[model samples]
Target chain A: MLDQQKVFYGILGLAVLATLGWGMSTAGPAGLAFAGAASFTIGGALMCLWERSIVRSAFSLMATFCGVGVLFILLGADFVGMAQILIYVGGILALLLFGVMLSPPDMTERKLVRVGGGLLTMGLGVAWVAGKVAATVKWAALPIDQLPEPKSHAEEIGVAFIHPEQYVVPFELAAVLLTVALVAAVYIARRKMSDFVPEVASQQENA
Target chain B: MLSNITTTAATTAAAAAPSENVVFHLLAEYVPEGVPGWILPIVTASISVGIVIALISVMAMGFTWLERKVSGHIQCRYGPMYAGGWHGWAQPIADGVKLLMKEDLIPIGADKALFMMAPAIVLGAIFGAFVAMPLAPDFYFADVNLGIFFILGMSSLTTIGVVMAGWSSNSKWSLYGAMREAAQVVAYEIPLGISLLVPLIVAGTFNLREASELQGDFYGMGWFVFKNPFMLPASILFFIAALAETKRAPFDLPEAESELVAGFLTEYSGIRWSFFFMEEYAAMYLMCLVASVFFFGGFESPFTYMAREQFGPNAFITNVVAASTLIVKSIAGIVLMMWVRWTLPRVRIDQVMTIGYKYLTPLALICVLGAACWEAIF
Candidate 1:
C-alpha cells in the first residue's frame, strides 16, 4: 500500500530514468549532460518526500548537492565545481549546522515543519530555473572528445583576480571590503570586552 | 618575449595531457592493435581505481606505523618491536586484524544511524583526495582541471563528518568538542586559503602541472621557498595555518586529550577511533603535499633538469625521486607538528581566537601585500 504522493514520484522516476538511459545510449559521454540534470531533479524529489526526518533529509540534500558538483565537473567548469563543493558543502552547510545547534532544541521539529512549505516552494522555483537553464543553454562549441583535467582552482581564481582585463578592480575592491569587514567585526566584538578590563591602582590614582 | 615563448612551449606537453585522459591513453596504448576502443578506457579506469585504492590503503597503514615509531622515539622507547620481526614493521597490519575482530559497541544514548554514517563520511572525504595527487609525471587517478581546489573542497568536507560524530554521540564532552573543533577549523581556513594564494599569484596559473613545470628550470636556488623573499614568510604562514587546519600542535584545541579526552572522538572506540586517526594523518600528509608543491619544487630535482634537457618518459623515475624529496620535506613538517604536540602548552580557547584573528590574519595580509610588491619590483 503506497501513498498517492509516492506513486506519483515513482512514476516520475521511471520517466526520468527512461529519458536518462536514452540520452546515455545516444550521447555516449556527452549525454552526461541530461544524466546530471536528472540527478538534481530526482534528488530534489526525494528531499520533498522526506518529511518525516530532518536529519535524513539534510544528508540526502548533501548527496544531491554533491551530485550537482559532479555535474559541474562533467561540464568542464572545474573551478565552478570546486567552488560549489567548497562554498555550499563547507561554508553554507556548516553555517546551517551551526544554526541547528544554536536553535532552541524543543522547537527543532516544529520549526522544520513550519518552514517546509516555504522551502519547498523556493526549491521548486530554483529547480524550474535549473531546468530552464539546462534546456536552453548551448555548449556546441565546447570540446566533446576530451575532458579537462583538474588544476588548482584557488590559484586560477586568485590569478584571475590579479588580471587587469578580467577582475583587477573588483579584486582590489574586495580586498578593501574584506579589510573593512575585519576591522568592523574586530571593533564590534572588542567593544563589549572593555568592561572586563581591570583598572590598575596606579592608573586609577593618575586618572 | 623569448622567455615567455619558451615558458609557454615548456608547459604545452605537460599541461595538455590531463591525468584522467592520460590514464585512458595509456590503457589504449597497451591494448593489442585490433582491440575494441571502449574496452581500453574501461580497463584503464578499473586499473586506475585499483591502484588508487591500494595506494591509499598502503599509505594509511604505513602512516600508522610511522606515527608509532615517531611517537615512540619522542618518548624515549622503541615501539612495536614484537609484532612481526624487524622494528615492528607489520604492527599496523596486526592492529588492523585485532580491531576487525573486536566487538563493535554502540552507546545507549547515541543516535545509531548518524553514529555509523559519520565515520564513513570522514573516511570517504579523506580517501577522495588520492584521485587528484600526481604520483609521478602522468600518474594520477583523475586530474580534474581544478585538482588542488578539489582537494581543499574535499578536505573541508571532513569537518561535517567530524561535527556529525561529535553531535550524534549525545554526550556533553562530545558536543563541546564538536563546537570547539568546528570553530577552530573555520577560523584557520581563512589564513590557509590566503597563504596558498601567495604561490598561485607568482605562478600565474592554477594548474599544478604548470606550476611544477615552471619550476623545472632553476638557475639559482630554484624552489619557490626561495623564489622570492616574500615566499619564505608566506610558506611559514602556510605551514602554521596547515597545523591549525589539521588540528595539530598548540592549534589542536579540539583533541586536547587532557581537556576533552580525545575531544569529539571521546566516545569512539576500536577501529572507529583509528578511522579518526587515519583521517587526521592523511590530512597532515595532504597539507604537507600542498606545502611542498607551493613552496618546494614538485617532482623537479635541483639540477637534474639542467643536466638533461631531452628527458622523456624515463624522466618519470627522476620525477618520482624528486617527489620523494617533497615527501621527506612534508614528513619533516609532520615531525615538527609532532614535536609541537609533545612540547608546547595548549592555549586557552579565547587566546586561540586572539592569535588567529589578531595576529595570523594581519600578518598573512601583510605578507600577501609584500609578496605582491616584491613581484612588481623584482
Candidate 2:
C-alpha cells in the first residue's frame, strides 16, 4: 500500500545517504560541500518540475540560481556570488514576480513533447559544460593545489575590470550599452501621451 | 603605481589576508582540543546565529515599544501606561506572549506551503544580511570584504518573500500589498545603492570596520559627510530611499492601513503575523546602521576616542563605548524615521514611483559624479 511517489523519495533518500557516506570516507570536506551544493541545485530543479503553480516554479528557479551563487562562492569568487544574487535573484527575479502579479494560472495540461525536449536540452547542456570545460580550459586564475592565502577577491576583480591593458574598454562599453538599453526600454514603455494630451503619436515616435 | 581607489596600502594589503572572526577565535582559544576540528565551524556558526537572533528579538521588542510611545506622544496621549509600570515598559514582552499563544491560521484557499514559508524567508533573508553587520571593530559575525554589497543583495532577496506572502495569502489586499512592495523596492534600490556610493568613494573600502576606523581622525569629527561635500546630499537621498526600502511612512504603501487593510498581512495572524513586523524593524535598524557607518562616523565618536585613549585601543572598555555609540546613532536614526512617519502622510503609489525614479535616482547619480570628480581632483 505504499504510494509510488513516497517509494521513489525513500529510495532517493537512501541512495543519497549511502553516497554521502562513501564520499565522506574518500573525499572528506570537499565531497560534503559538493554534495550540499548539488542537493540545492537538483532539489530546486526537481521542485521546479514537480510544482503545479508557475509562481512556485519560478521560486524554485530562484533556488537554483541561489545554489549556483553558492557554488561561485565555493570557487573563491565572492564578488561574483554577491553580484549573481543581487542581479539575478534581487533584480531579475523581483521584476519577473512583479510581472506575474503574484498570480498563478491554473495549469492542467502537461505536454510530453515539451518535457522530453526540455530534458534533452538540459542533458546536452550538462554534458557540454561538465565534460569539455573540465578537460580543456586552462585555469590561470588560480591553480587548486597552490591556493593563494586568502586575498580580497573583490579587489582583484575591481583591478581586472579597470586595468588599462585589460578590461577597461569592455567595461565602459558594457556600461554605456546598458545605459542605452535602459533609456530605450523606458522610452518604449512610455504611454504615447503628448503635450497637453493632444495626440497619440506626438511623442518619441512622432518626433 | 596603482590607482588610489582605496588608501593605506598596508591596510589594503592586510585586508586581503584571511583571519578568523572573533567568536571563532574565542571558541578556538577557550574550547578544548579534544573536540573534532570539523565541528568547530558548526559550533561557531550556531553561536553567531544565537547571538544575532537574541539581538534582533530584543531590538524588535524595543522598537515596538518605542513606536507606540512615539505615536501616542505625537497624538498628545500616553500609550500603554498600564501594561507595565513606567509607561508600559513591558508592553512588548506582553505583546510577544500574546502573539506566541494565539492560534495560527491559514486561509483554506491559501497555498499552504508558501503561506508557512513566507515569514521564514523574510526573516531568514534579514538574518543573512545581519551577517555582515559588525557590532564593534573586533566583534562581528563575519568579516566579509564585500560587506555592504552583500547586505544590499540580501535585502533585495526579501522582496521575494513579501511577494510570496501576498500571493499565497489568496486575498486581494495581500496581492495588492505584495505588488506594491516589489515595485517600491525595485524603484528605490537604484537610488539606495547609488547614493551609498557617494560615501563609498570617499571611504574606498566597503568593510564597515575600515570605514569607521578611517573616521577616527579629528576627535572622531572626521565623518564621511565632513570629508566630501556631496556626501550630505547623498546621505539625504540615501535616507529617503531607505525609508521606501523599509516601507516606513510616506512609503509604507504595501501595508498602508487606510487603503490595503493591513496589506500583505490581511490573512496572517499570531506569530506568523509578527515575523513581518520583526523584519520591518530589523531592516529599518540595518538601513540606519548602514547610514551611520557610511556617512555618520560609525563607532567613531569623541566618546569612543576618549575611551580608546584612556584604555588601550583593543580594550574591552573601548569596544563597549564604541558599541554604545553605534547603538545610539542607530537609535537616533530610528527616531528620525518614526518622527517622519508620524508627521508625513503616505504618498500615492504612483507618486512613490515618480519620486524614486525621477528625482532620487538622478540626484544620486549626480552626487556620485560630483563625488568622483572631487576625489579625482582633490
Candidate 3:
C-alpha cells in the first residue's frame, strides 16, 4: 500500500514537470506560472479522487477550485477569477465540507457496479474535454485594441447581468431557485422538537 | 470609423492609467542602472511580502497588549501593570518568548500532519488577503482590480483552516467549534458582502485605493457615509458581520471559553495556538481597514489634507501622513471592536443564527436597495 501511494505521488510530480516544460516552451517566463497552476489543478483533482478521508477529499476539491481561479486570473479575466473563488471556494465548498463533516464517518464501502459506472463516466468526460481542446485553436488570443479599457470589469458585468436583452431572466431565475432551495433546506434541517420534547418530559418525570 | 476610434481611445486610456504598481517604479528609480528589468518585479514582490508580514506581526503584538489593558479596565482591574513597567508595555514580548519556549505537542489521537498544517493555512490566507490592502494611496502589495472581492475570498479561506484544525484535533470540543464556525460563516457571510454593496455602488469602483481617492474631495472629508444615508446602516451591518466573521465576543461561539473550554484551541498550544490568535488579530484589522476604506475616509484626514496642500500631492510627506491616518483609523476601529468584546456578553448559539440570518441579512438587503435607489435619484 505504501509503495502504491509513493508511485501515485511520483506520477503526479512527473506530470507537473512535464506541464512546466510545455508551458515554458509556449509562453516563456509567464508559462512557468501557468504550468504550475495547471499541474496544481490536475493534482488536486487526482488527490480528491484518491484520498480515503472524506474531509480531506472535500478540501482537495477546494484546491482544484482555487487552482481554476488562478488560471482565470492568468487569462486576464479578473472579475471571473475573483468571483470564482468568492462563490465556489468561499461559499459552495464550505457547504460541501459541512455536508461531508455532518455525515456518517464509516462510509468506506466499495461496490463493483458503482466503480464500473464511475470509471465509464470519467473516461467519457476526459475524452470529451480532450476532443474540445483539440477542436479549439487560439480561442484566447483577442486583439489588444479591441478589448475594453476598464481596469475593473465588475460594474460592466453587473450591468450585463441585469440587462433586458442579456442575462436578467436567468439571473432572477437563479435567485428564485436558490430561495426555494434555502426554504427546503430550512424545512429539512430544522430541529424536530415535537419528538424530542415529549421524550425529555417523560424522562424528567421518571427522574 | 468606430473601430479606429476605439483603438486610439483604448491606447490613450491605458497609457493614462497609473503604472501597474508604484513599488515597481520606486524599485526602478533606486536600483542600479545595470540591473535587469525582470528582476525588479521579483524584488518588489519580496519587499511587499516582508513589509506586510512585519506589519501583521507588530500589529498582533501591539493589539495583544492593548486587548489585555482594555479588558482589564472594562472589568475594573489593573491588568498586568508590572512587566516592563508602564502598564505592562512589554507584556506581549514576554508572552511571545514564553510561548516560543513551550513544548510543541500533538495529541496522540490528533491527525499529526493536519494538526501542523492548519495554523499555517489560516495565517497564509490572511497574508494573501493583505496583498490587496492599501496602506496609502501609492503603497500596496497588489493593485487588484477587484480588491475587495479578492480580500473577501481570501479571508474566507481561513474558515477552511479553522475547520481543518478543529476536525484534525479529534476532540469533541474541537468538532463542536468547527460546527459552530460552519454555521456562523454560512449565516453571516451573505450579510457581510451585501452590506458592502452600499459603498461599492457609491464609489463606483472595487479598488480600495481608487475608492479612497474618490472620497478625497472637500479637504479629505467626503466619506461615503456623508454621501449616502444608507451607508451608515450598511457600515453598522458591516461592523456586526466583521465582529462575527472575526469571531469576536457575542458571536464567538466557535471558541467560547466558558462553554467549550477553548473550542478549536483545545488541542493547540504553544506557538501553534499563537498562530491562530495572530490570524484572528490580523483578520480583525483587515476587516476594519476595509470598513474605513469603504465607509469612512481612508488615508484621508485633516493632517493628510494639510500635508498634501503644503507639499503638493506628489510629496513623500503626504504619503506618510496618509499612511499614518489609515493606521490610526484602523486602530480606532480595532479598539471599538475590543470595547464591544469587553462590554457585551456572548449570545446563545440559536440567538446568533437568528440575529445573523433573520435580522442582519434583511437589514443588509434593505440598505442595498435604499442605496441603489438613492444613487439613482439625487
lDDT of each: 0.68, 0.81, 0.81
TM-score of 1: 0.80
Candidate 3 residue-wise lDDT, B1-378, digit = tens: 111111111112222223356767877878987875546665666676667778898899999999999999989997889899899999999999999999998999887767888888788778778878888877766776678988898888888888889989999999899888988997899999999999999998888999998888888899999999899999999999999999999799999999999998999999999999999999999999999999999998778888989998878888889989999999999999999999999999999999998999999999999999999999
Q: How does candidate 3 score on lDDT?
A: 0.81
lDDT of 2 at B46: 59
What are the RMSDs of all candidates, in order? 7.7, 6.5, 6.6
Ranking by DockQ: 2, 3, 1
Decide which is better by TM-score, 1 or 2.
2
The better-scoring model by lDDT among 1 and 3 is 3
DockQ, each predicted model: 0.28, 0.41, 0.36
> For model 1 chain B, where is the 10-residue window of minimal lDDT?
B1-10
- In candidate 3, list every pair of residues with a backbone clash: none
Q: Each candidate's iRMS in angstroms?
A: 9.5, 7.9, 9.3
lDDT of 3 by residue, A93-153 (tens): 8878777875544446556587688779999999999899878856567332222333656
Best candidate according to TM-score: 2
Q: What digit string (tens of lDDT, one per residue) describes model 2 on residues B4-55?
A: 1011111111222243667788888887768766566656665776787789
